[model samples]
Target: MPDLKDLNSIYLIVAFVVPGLIATFVRAQFINGRIDKMTDTVLGYLVITLIYYGFSIPVISWILTFEQGLLKTALWWGLTIVGPACFGLLLGVAAQHGWLRWMAKKLGLRVVHGTPSSWDWQFANCYAARFVMVTLTDGSSIAGIFGTASFASTDPTERDIYIQEVLDVDANGIWNYRSEPSGILILAKEIRAVEFMKEL
Candidate 1:
């Protein structure tokens, strides 16, 4: 059995948990609902924390070998935590930007453009500056040109978008914005579907 009263052992527990906590938070922010369950999140955090610390240990060890005072030691410890976090964040960004797709193409692999992996990228890339009809869950809809759309990387299900030149659909189902010609805000819970119109 291990000695529970040891101070170093407590620090070891903290060291083990900190990386996972930071990794999980970063990944949750970046990937959003990709991790649905608590168990999945915990498992993913453990795996990523392991991978990060595996690479970080040697570098941290080498840096700590340098002579340092109290302040410098604290700075090194800060670096140890921040370095892996920055790396994890960069990885998340690269993943979101379709880096994998780009790599596959470079390797002579064929993949479809406008893949659904990154919904925010897809919306901003494909739908921005284009006309669309946002159908609400209650059977009403507003058509307009997509001006600025905001995506929730923190909560993937939260669909919030902004529209310019807001149009009202007549009983004949035609859209006209001449009367209003203002902006409209749409929320996710109210939206049922989005119909793409002509590109501008």
Candidate 2:
């Protein structure tokens, strides 16, 4: 026969552990920018916790009335195992629906995709007074100039330029390259603007 104290302790442990496990699983499945995903993940976890508590109270109360011995313990174990799994699955599904992508756009970040061209390299060496390497896919932008061709690679259809420094360009089309992280070399022909960053 489980005592009242034992039942209470078991319930408390289940209540805490279930939500935590759910939150952990949610975090693991979704990979994106940290700040954006974290906010949504926390909000989801809170809602799941509330729902679990609300439903469990009535169910546990009813179970306690019928089976007075180890019934509460069994219920606690069930909730601990099941509650988090369900919540984690829900969060994982929500994450796949462009949640992080939308958040990145909201924050004035966008992704672009393109291959490099030979003309781009020529432009970099000659006409490209400076260079700004913008990673449209990752929403990361680096600025530098055509210091030198650190490395180069290409396929039958495209070329890539690895710039020693990233260049910065203004709306006026002025090139201003500065010393920054080493970036990839891409051909100019392959360069294509995919997305834009709107003011958030």
Candidate 3:
């Protein structure tokens, strides 16, 4: 092992560690997971880096065979930086769409989903706007529009919601726009259930 103060050791760290961090960060942007802990994140980066390197060994070997030249430098750059970035993007997309999971299922392997919870999945996939009726634990229901402006908490533990354009639900179940409140923020603890209805 090289000394920490040595220039070669520093270069080795930069060549390997930076790419892994970049890939992990890129993957996190597309996938939802409980990665709040520092230790867990660091460990994940290291693990991902190792796995990436393992898979990229063939390419690394091929690059090493080239004599020192501009092409060799470019290939080295691809191995160190561009390669990992592209790998992260493709990996994240594959995981996000369950392509990897689907394939793993064929092999009878146990695998977990990328999303933290169903709440994130629902809000993420529900692109079209609709009338949302939120029932509270206190037995009260608030009706509003779950449009582009509305928000759902992505935090796995926090199942909060924000409904834009409050509505009045009459006895006949007709929804009318409220004149007072613009939107309502419902906390996770208070929420009992949520119903989405198509606009009439």
After superposition, candidate 2 runs with Cα above 4 Å error: 1-14, 30-48, 55-58, 70-72, 98-200
RMSD in Å for model 2: 15.8
Q: Between the candidate structures 1 and 3, which one is better when assessed by lDDT?
A: 3
Candidate 2 TM-score, true structure as reference: 0.33
**Local error of candidate 3 at residue 94 (angstroms):** 1.9
Highest TM-score: which candidate?
3
Off by over 4 Å in 1: 1-10, 33-40, 101-129, 138-140, 149-165, 168-179, 187-189, 197-200
Candidate 1 lDDT, 15-107, residue by residue in tens: 664576565555444444244465446555567667777878787777678777886777566654776578667666665576867999899
Clashes of each: 0, 23, 0
The sequence of per-residue lDDT tens digits that candidate 3 reaches over residues 65-126 is 99999999999877878878887898888866778988999999978777766777677666
Looking at candidate 1, the ten consecutive residues that score lowest on lDDT are: 147-156
Question: TM-score for each prediction?
Answer: 0.63, 0.33, 0.73
User: CA lDDT of each candidate?
Assistant: 0.65, 0.50, 0.80
lDDT of 2 by residue, 1-200 (tens): 22437988666544654475564565434422122244455555556677666766876676667655586767666666666666556555455444555777899987441113433323323422343454444454544544444433324344454556555668896656455554555553555431222211
Worst 10 residues of 3 by lDDT: 31-40
1 against 2, candidate with superior TM-score: 1
- Choose 2 or 3, whichever is better by lDDT: 3
